[model samples]
Target: MQFLPQAPTDRHTTLEDLQGIVTGVTMVALSVQFLQAAELITGQIAGLSLVASYPTGLSFGLVFFLLNLPFYVFAILQIGWRFTLRTFLAVALLSALVELMPRAFSLSGVHPGAAAVLAGISAGVGLLVLFRHGATLGGVGILALWLQDRTTLRAGQVQLGFDLVVFTLALFLLPLATVLWSLLGAVILNVIILTNHRRDRYIASS
Candidate 1:
C-alpha cells in the first residue's frame, strides 16, 4: 500500500515561544485564581497543590513548585533536556504568577459553577498553548505528553485517568460536593485537550 507524506511542521521562533509560554502560564494562573475563589480544586499537580494548601496553610505556589521537583529527573529521562528546561521555566513562572496575581486583584463572589467552567476553559487553552510551544507546566503534564508521544494514548486521556486518582484522594480531604464540582472542571479541561490537541492537525514544533 502507498502512504502519503506527513504534513510539514513549522518551528516557532524564540520570541514566539517566549510570548506563547508567557500567555499560557498567565492563563493558567488566572484559572488558579478562579479555583481558589470558589474553594474548588481541579486535578493533576495543581489540584494536589490546592488540596495540600487548603488545610496546611501553605502557599499553593510553594507546594506546586516543590512537588514538581522530583519530576524533573523523570522528564529528562523520558523527554529531553530542552523540554525539561522549558517545563521548569513554565512551572516557575506559573508559581510566581499564582503568588503575585492575587496581590494585583482578588476575585470575590464567584459562583462555584462559573468558576469551574471558567477555570476549565482557561486552563485547557493555556495547556494547549504550552504543548504546542514544546513545554508543559511540569508534573502530570510532563507524564501526559510523554505518554502521548510514546504510545497511542491521548495526553488528555492520560491526565483524566490520573485525575481520577487525585479526586479519589480528595474525597478523603474535601467535601463530596466540592469534589464533584471540581471533577466537572477537570472533565471540561481534559475534553478540550482530547478534542483539540491532535498532533495530526497541529504540526508545529518549537
Candidate 2:
C-alpha cells in the first residue's frame, strides 16, 4: 500500500517552516490583541480562553493552548495523525505568540468598535493562511469543516452557529453592548473566510 505524502508542501527549508510559524503567530496575536482591546469575545476555544483569562491571569495564548489539547485527540481520532500534528504545531506557535505579544506591543485605549473590525480581519486572514496550507489552528473550526463534508450544511454556517453560542456566553460576563461588538466581529470574520477561503479561489493551478 502506498501511503500519501505527509503534507501538500515540502516541510523542509528553514524559510518555509518559519513562514508558517510566523504567520500563525502574528495573526493569532493580532486576534488576541483585537479581542482584548474590544473587550469582546469570539467563538470556540478562543472565546473560552478569553473567559478563562479573566480569572486565571493566564495569558489568552496559554488558555487557548490548554483548551485545544483535548481537541487534538479528537482531531487525531476523527481526522488523521498528519492533520493533528500540523494543528498542534500551529496552535503551539499561536500560543507562544500570544504570550509574547504583551512584551512586543501594548493596547492602551482602543475603542471597542475599531478593535472589533481589526480583530475580525486579523483572525479571518490568519485562519485563511492555515486553511490554505492544509493545516489548522484547531477547535470547533476543525469540527465544523469535518461536519460540512459529511452533512449538507455549509461550513461557514456551522461555524457561525458555534460563534453564536460563544458570544452568547459573553453576555453574562460583559455588558450587552460589548457582546454586540463581538457578534459584529464574528460576522466580519466569517464573511472574510467564506468569500476568500474557497478552494477554487485559493488553490493555484499546479
Provide TM-scores for the models: 0.96, 0.85
Number of clashes found in candidate 2: 0
Scored by Cα lDDT, where does model 2 land? 0.76
Worst 10 residues of 2 by lDDT: 197-206
Cα lDDT of candidate 1 equals: 0.94
Clashing pairs in 1: none
- Candidate whose lDDT is highest: 1
C-alpha RMSD for every candidate: 2.6, 5.7
Query: How far is 2's C-alpha from truth in model 2 (Å)?
Result: 37
For model 2, how does the per-residue alpha-carbon lDDT over 1-206 read when each residue is reduced to its tens digit? Answer: 97543433333454555576568557867888878876677777888888788767887877788889888888888888977787888889888887778888889788888888888889878876776555677898788667865777655777788898888778788789988988888888888877776543443211
CA deviation > 4 Å runs, candidate 1: 1-6
What lDDT would each prediction earn against the true structure?
0.94, 0.76
Give per-residue CA lDDT, model 1, range 20-49, as digits (tens): 999999999999999999999989999999
What's the C-alpha lDDT at position 118 in model 2? 89
